[model samples]
Target: MVAENSTPHLHSAVEPRQTFRRALDMAARAAMPSLFVMFCAILLSAPFGIPGQAQLQFGIAMCTVWFWAYSRPRSMPALAVFLCGLVVEIFSFGPPGTVLLSLLVIYGVAHHWRYGLSRLGFIAGWLIFSIFAVLASFFQWALVCLHAVALLSPAPGLFQAALTIGIYPSLTALFVWGRRTFANPDQA
Candidate 1:
């Protein structure tokens, strides 16, 4: 009762290779967010020694996580966020968990609003990020102060939030390009 020219056998023979390809594609997709965080960590560790570089480094790092979480929650998993935190601890010479905690807060906020934000467009997204950045940065400042047993100056943290909010549009475009270039066709 089957058609003689049916290509079901051809598809069956190709299934294993297709399955392997899909596995690799999924892996690469997962890696893209981690790759961005790793790159930021490298920047944090680099001896550029520029003033306020730490602020810039952490800002970009947190924004990278938030960006992916907001845009593609599946790509920025909790495990990857944790690894990014570990990377920040190793690279930034800060008390452990400082950067990680701040990033987690950002990820949580972004993920929570991901569905609504995706439809709301850039201004609204940027506005929401502004408020969240301030709160998250303040929390990070308090933690660092508590860990050091002295009230730390919060200027750097404030600067970081400002810089992140300022640069998000450009960075979002770059992240979009990255996803387009590296993401699997199915996801695209």
Candidate 2:
């Protein structure tokens, strides 16, 4: 009788541990996308001596937002997207709200097309993202020009868009690996 009673207590103790572990896993999965984007934003902001570093960072940030928003809208909610954009804007020396607005627009488009993008091939997704990169670059350039009250050269913006489109496949592969490794297997 004592053995039977002790068995129940042991099982109960293990149950709570399992429950806690499951909850922790779910929370980590839920937070991963936003956390990853913020990490990228901070990491890319580091002062590398490469030419066009700011443009490269901004392009990478855009790619991060697009991937998360399209692939896992639930994980990367609008509020998190806003916060990520704010982080990017704070890190970069661009005009206020430029990166934020661009990211928000990207998030909106990605979220809206999430299902379609998910069903489409990688090439189709890349083409769509390329269009977004160009539009975001143009939008940011327009905002900067308006802020400065003078027309700025469009060269940097064009370069940023091209760089972003060029790096999509590589960043996407990293994101896919992260999703497979860290996210719930069923979810991935």
Candidate 3:
């Protein structure tokens, strides 16, 4: 209370509580992208109106996670992508190792071809990967058919594949917009 003539020290007078609040804000911002991804997967996978439709839609989560890795390869490490895919596989009732293997393979291919993929811009790259995802799904289905005595039908599976491809571009666009608007600068 003795600053009548002397210049006031603005930052020096700031309370520790304000600094703590600012830190919390920064931390929350940094965490939002991962939180969003987790939320999207859980929400989309939750038991819904149609089970077959739900199964098909689950691929969108995998697509989003893969696209994030593709778009920001330097930040989203291979290990993280693999781990995330493993978690997805556990939640998804498909072949034990198939989804995880496919995801990693997709990630690797996407990474190797990223320079060209990036040059094609967002939607084009997304469509390319969507085609790859459908092909990979069909390959996995073929393996399942070979192993199972009952024989898995390809018709429903192919329909699911087509549905996934049809929805992929729009979902990828949503993720791209989210990444641009909500992702942390440092996280990417």
Sort all candidates by lDDT, best to worst.
2, 1, 3
Clashing pairs in 1: none
Provide the TM-score for each candidate, comma-separated.
0.81, 0.82, 0.71
TM-score of 1: 0.81
Best by TM-score: 2
Residue 76 Cα positional deviation in candidate 2, in Å, after optimal superposition: 0.7
Instruction: Summarize candidate 1's per-residue lDDT along 1-188 as a digit string, tens digits.
Output: 45766646755664545577777777877687787778778776888878767776677777788888888888888888888878877888665677888888888888888888889877888788888778877887887899889988999778877987887888888887876777534452
Residues 1-188, candidate 3, lDDT per residue (tens digit)? 55784776665665344466667665655445345545655566677766564445346645755666667665355776666666666666666777667767777887888778767876677677777777877877877887785577788667766776776777777767766665544332
Worst 10 residues of 2 by lDDT: 9-18
CA lDDT, every model vs. true structure: 0.78, 0.83, 0.65
Q: Give the alpha carbon lDDT tens digit for every residue of 1-188 in model 2.
A: 78766655544554444466677777788778767767777776787677877887678778888998888777788998898888888888887888888889889999998999999999999999999899989988998899889999999999989999998999899888877778643342
* Cα RMSD (angstroms) for every candidate in the order listed: 4.1, 6.3, 7.5
What overall lDDT, based on C-alpha atoms, would model 3 receive against the true structure?
0.65
Give candidate 2's TM-score: 0.82
Show pairs that collide, candidate 3: none
lDDT winner among the candidates?
2
